[model samples]
Target chain A: MKTVYVCSNTVTGIYSAIYDAWKARKGEEECSVALRGAVETELFCEYVEVEETVHKAQAVEALICRHLGREAYWDIYHAVLAADTGKGDAILGAMLAAKTIPDSRRIMEHLSHPKVEKVFELSRSVIGEAHFLKGAVRFRELAGGVLYARISPKAQVLTCLAPHFADRLPLENWMIYDRVHRMFVIHEAKKRWILVQDEFLDPERLPDLTEEEKEYTKLWKGFVHAVSVESRENLKLQRQHLPLRFRPDMVEYM
Target chain B: MSSSESMTTYTYEGIPQYMPQGAGGLRPSMFQKLNILADAAKYDVACTSSGTARSNDGTGMGSCERSGICHSYSADGRCISLLKILFTNECIYDCKYCINRRSNDVIRTSFTPDEVCTLTIEFYRRNYIEGLFLSSGILRSPDYTMELIYAAIYKLRKEYNFQGYIHVKAIPGASKELIQKVGFLADRMSVNLELPTAESLKLLAPHKTRKNILTPMRLVQNRMAENKQELALYRNAPGFVPAGQSTQMIIGATPETDFQIMQVAQSLYQRFELKRVFYSAFIHVNEDSLLPARTDEGPPLLREHRLYQADWLLRYYHFRAEELLSEENPNFNVLFDPKCNWALKHLGQFPVEINRADYKMLLRVPGLGYKSAVRIVKARRVGTLDFSDLKKIGVVLKRAMYFITCNGKMLYPTKLEEDYIARNLLSAGEKLPGEVVNMGYHQLSLFDDVGFSGKMQQYM
Candidate 1:
């Protein structure tokens, strides 16, 4: 029998834990698997704790992103996080299994595997949002070398969102904080990355809100409003394209 | 004031792609300039990252995932996810078809390196685009024009530390050194073939030559190869063009057939490792007498779409140019997509037992998109995927049903006849605007006053 550790939060967090689990597996210690964000009773094996480390997290990220391939990395990340089980060991085992198989997208082992379904569904939603938000989301520079913004997604999609930002803004001094999850991704490519999770997010805490932000905010809002023509006041079409839910956060919608 | 900047749609009424000034020549706000440029640029369907190798090196600033990003969509019904704009609309080369040609009498403008860097960072921050897609008409000299473009890209990537996707166009006559410099900074670089054939280029665009155009393209391809080789040898070779290089060919411009265009595209990919080959449909702009007159009916937009489909097939589906078209047939079928049409010709290959068909065979099936082809591989391993299961997963059976079989059973009862199926599929889409216009759209327009249609056809 083996003890399984579960990590059921973000892709980075799970990846960080994967680094730990892989190391343990290589050792003489017994290893087992479970999904994150899960709670249950331990039968026999002693539970061991692994703290998140940047070095371990970096290795997992590099392995998935560099060695594994782009699409697979996305699929595994989504699948790993979407599974409701907090048995981190199980998820990690499944992820490791996925890596070995050339064709990783085998839906799920079981039909009702929440993580597998979540991975598929969330990836789709995140991709769609990323495409649209590539236009809708606005970013501004905050002090402390952080680029800050908020994304309101329909499907729980903070995990899938970071890679796009990470890929595009890797070298840039930036941070994308998911307010819904109270998590933030800090990326300074080739420099240092700090991912803050399960912590308080104070919007005002981000530095560097100068006059430029104020002016651009007003300007962006005006541009969006100006583009909406009264001649074609098709609220249905407008709402179809830009939903009421997203408008609260977006300046153009406002 | 530029017509594009003033009015809504580009009806080609006044100078298109120009920033409209209000009243007595007032400067438009930066936001308004972007709207105009974004709207103007939405039509250029060139910013793509597919059919290329992935970024394996850890040394590059960033990489372009196989799935492309559309920073934003402009009014012209294309992605504006990139900062698509001209370095300067002030062109000395009087390409008759260009909106920004010297003789067009339009308001000219240029953006400095600093200005471009600021806009890209700003738009990128707001999540407006992935990066910059910068192109320019020949300004001053080719080298000089190229220098400004390189300066801006380098400034954005180097100075601002911007790792966003930058797709820059290399001026035909630009120096090899300059092209290499930008190649290092840009994720993707392209030199527009502009016209399909050398003949059309000579006739319509007398200033540009085949040698001038292909030289820079060849140079970039060589440098990219060298970079990859170096990576293998040293594992620390500096990145050249991480996204690789892609080129554009203006469709419907010349008398070149889809076969000829595909051959060029195939050679570019084989010779240069091209990421993509964009096919921009020609829309007439001038009254260049040397050009064949295209009637008001316009260049074949459907043909252009089909060419793109054919291009995709050539690049990914492992379909060869000879397999797709011949010198006799030349053009793609106006109705069915190239993949479906190709499969219909080779019916013997299908019904190969989905359980056993290889990746290449599965890719050949109609309705199996890039993803579906990939999906079929995984699903079959769990168990032999039946026709019903394929549909449940994602395959569009409407088209594939005609081509494929489930466990040696054809879906339909009737005998398979390629001709019969093709005709039905021919009348499938809208009547293709006008079918019986036997002559090419250009031939009929010559007698009628040489209108905009004639000029754009040269580049098409």
Candidate 2:
């Protein structure tokens, strides 16, 4: 019988499904995996919903750490954080390949392997977006005296970007809200930053910029207007470097 | 006056605005001033922010990372919008090649010290830029311009308390005391060499002599060296141009050969310890009979790209300029890159055993960059690295295959003949920039050379 295992949309939940699937060993072609919110059911397939059990997830984690080493685990973990709907199944397929193929710990480097290639591609996108946002994220001084910045990244990158800002502006009170994910990485002056989830942060309810903020924004807009060389103006190249989606939040573009 | 007096933003029209004082007695809007100055300053190509590691103190609002952050790239695939504007576009000299020459009918304006600091700090706070790249035309004299630059940087550091990277141009004939003062506050300083040769400099820029440019460069170099010694003794001795100095030479404007340019660059690196030598593909702005006529192909961008590639080979690949090109071979081959051309010419260096060659030897091979060379050394230690392992380590086997051997075995029994490898390299041409390829000037490749496709499929 062709069986489809569905699980929650998270790393731990996916790991639990992988654990159950491995224990069954119903052959690679017969068993399939999908995330909870995703429509991935095949016709005539027996569907099984896997509960996210801590023990089951830990069991899969231990198996991966033992066989593929720590680096492979990180590779799988980062790739899972990608916005791809098929990420859960991609990791499951890669894990199964690791079990079957000898010396498959180097699978991430193998572009020929479909599942491995998918994971590698997704990991690069997630990492690349995070790196770009490090330079792109703009901070505005809010009325309450804390610095505030908002980003609507496609990937779930708040966790990836938090540590960098924490180390950078340790003594300042700041908050970087991931508007798409409805999560915030808040850092108090001289204190460690913490991640908070609140889906109710309305776009209309953002605080007004301080007067000092207004002057700086005016200055920045003036500078940006002045800096670009009119003779060699390449709007196409500028679009490639800083995409249009990033324009709405950027003060200069506004 | 206290430094704070010069630190305040230059106020105009009853509000604090950093607009330049007009030499032409014209009060242009801030926007207009920016447009004119930026247009004049655009020819300078050094928009780099690398090689500084300044962290923001608890009080400051910004930090400078050592690796350099490229906040944005321009239309020409160059990094831009680092507030790369001139303090003024007013000039004292009429260099034939310069857009900001006194003889040109362009608007003349100047920025006060306060205006520059305000712009730098504000833009930096918004993360729109990494830092500032300030260059200016000589307003009244070189000393006057250099003093204004010093005051601007001093206010930016002391008054604004901004600890970000700042790269300033040291005016060729600026006073030593003034240049030293600015050097302490600025991260990097550059003196434009203008042209490769003294003859070319005199021919184009009649007013500015070669000696005037080199004198300030040598002073900055010696002071930077002396500062290094003091830094070892005193922890906070204040670094002198902590990011080091660089210079730019205008290509295609003058009649200097690629060999002459490379030799000059090599000497600058060896003698003055310059951080970089920028080669700007000269875009014809002013209509001058003395300058090279604008050809159908526009700028010599391909030639500039080739020189930069050769520069990298000199810096990292341990290849000398003499080995790449001699008097007879003055120009680089347009068909292949410097490394591939070198390898093809000296076929005796072929089939370097990948597992046996040292790091420097591996670097000499085409397609093996510094990162890949290091990875090869690290990976081979654990086990024997076969062709599959080399592919996994991210080596570009297309070029490297002809040069490297796996366990003393060639990937395919490749011949060491120059024509054979050259044909393969041509057939497997990497994607070129549209600007470089669209000119229809490059020699057409013989991709349909018989049996090469069959040979390539055998490896696959």
Candidate 3:
């Protein structure tokens, strides 16, 4: 006499649905899982469609906190949200699976669901960039009272990376935009963060370095070049560790 | 080799790394000199993590990553965070072993106090590094170099108001007062043995002796202890080397046996309470004929990596150097990791049930890292961890297979053969031909067996 609906996409939407399911756990309300863009129903069933709501989303956050403490909540939430697939089903499974808090290494294992796999990939990509940024990121000062850089990354990593800079440069204002992803994270340090989605802002092109910037850059480049050991020029190993793509953004390379 | 370019010639004679040599004056191009010197000093492997301490307060520069990663790479390829560099490449001491020996016609340079401070701050501010890891070749007398260093660190701290991790190297023969002063400012300090033994020092580096290196090392360790004792009840006490002191020894340069290296490492850890002992695979950077025939016998990297792995065991796993290496078996087994190798030789210690083995016991099993060891301990707190759970705990059972059991079930079913398991773990055989690996454990008799060399055992 009752109905079960089960196809939905988007981890947030999926979590939103499970949150709805928990609310109606004692209800005789018919259920259906539908994809974000799709709706299908059988003849015998009365379809109940649930849209994602912040209030409903809050319950999922609570469930995540309860099921997988604060840190694990983040691990699961981000990993699920990162997946490019049946985010809803993955959430459904992960919520069920998060019953026991796994150790640090096992936490990564839960990230393998097709829906949230992209998050693991994205997070790993960001981590990879942070490491590369360690050796290569170059900054040049602008006369207009700003420091800027041009970096081309292979993933949607700009958002994940803003905090490290913000923590390091608490007094300075800076903008790191993924020109490719078309969104940039701007930090005012001791203030709120802003992510710009404005279409009018052009990001790909930037101004050149000024004289002061050029001077500092030359010193760094000379240091890197001159310090490079003639006895051991393992360019193969150097390039393997630091890819050529990151060179343009690094002060030592520039 | 040319007669003038005698293979045994060190850079500069009469000056020791222990004795710094001059009335240190302000040098303008300190930054360039530091890069030249530190680049040369990079061959010294003592820069471990200066640990995470950020200066990102409402002002200028730096945040440290929790990974404690710094300039150097780990065996599994983890980068160290510290912006490690030397103060000057111009050393007066000519240790035949060193690249910056007065003999090599390499670039000579030194970073001034201001230059050192500025580079550390700039690199840190750009989020390019965590903090400074400054070591220096003694530009002047050890006292003079100490003066320049103290000024540089003082400026970085007081003038610059930098609260970042600062790891400074201690110049031997510098007064204990100087050592005490530098230790209070820096998070960590170091003294390089360069060579392991006193006899070896006499032969290879005439300007230095074991006494010169060990004296300062002991003084620093003593000062660190005295400060730690005095500060026991105080909050944020001015302790010396909060991260503790570390030292480096060039591997393969001296004829000292692996036994000798392990012995010195053991004592350093035991006596000085050192945090680390880095083994630099001697790169044939300078052709010092006093060195062994620059054969394929380059600084054994695999050996260095193994030494580090063993050092980790000694520091963390409660393994003593004597237990790990001794007169009878002075070298680590090249076929298996130190832990697994140990377990193989001491099979009576194996077949430890994962669910019941104590933390110390679990650590002795091959293939179990700190994580797995901790996992084994923590998991047992809940319910018993079976063989399957052991796998989930990330224990590499290949080497550990002979050692641990889960719910009384072996991950692999077999009566363990010592040689079989040892050979099993040495899977990377002949990948590079004509090499006796770092352990000095290789015996041609072990290699002569045709079919027995079918494959090394693989303990997960």
lDDT of 3 by residue, A1-254 (tens): 44444434444466667776666652323443455555544577645566776677778888667655676565555444332443354444445444444652244454334423434454445466655554344456666535665556764455556666677677666666555545667777576557675443454455655676666665555545544444344566566666677666666654
What ranking emerges by DockQ with the best candidate at the front? Answer: 2, 3, 1
Error of 2 at B212 (Å): 2.1
Model 3 regions more than 4 Å off? A1-59, A66-68, A77-92, A97-140, A149-160, A179-181, A189-192, A197-201, A221-254, B1-35, B70-80, B226-239, B423-460
Q: Which candidate's DockQ is highest?
A: 2
* TM-score, model 2 to reference: 0.80
Model 3 clashes, total count? 49
Comparing 1 with 2 on lDDT, the higher-scoring candidate is 2
The fraction of reference A/B contacts recovered in model 1 reads 0.21
TM-score: model 1 vs. ground truth = 0.69
Q: What local lDDT score does residue A146 receive in model 1, on the 0 to 100 scale? A: 56
Candidate 2's residue-wise lDDT over A1-254, tens digit each? 87778887666778888887888986777777787878565788888999789899889889888888787887787787788888877887887777676686766655556887788788889988887787778889888877888888888788887776665565668888888878889899877788887555775788888998887777556655555555456688788888989777767677
**Estimated TM-score for each candidate:** 0.69, 0.80, 0.78
**lDDT winner:** 2
Best model per TM-score: 2
Q: What interface RMSD, in Å and to 1 decimal, does model 1 have?
A: 6.4
Candidate 1 lDDT tens digits, B333-365: 654567876877787776555667788988888
User: What are the interface RMSDs of all the models?
Assistant: 6.4, 3.2, 5.1
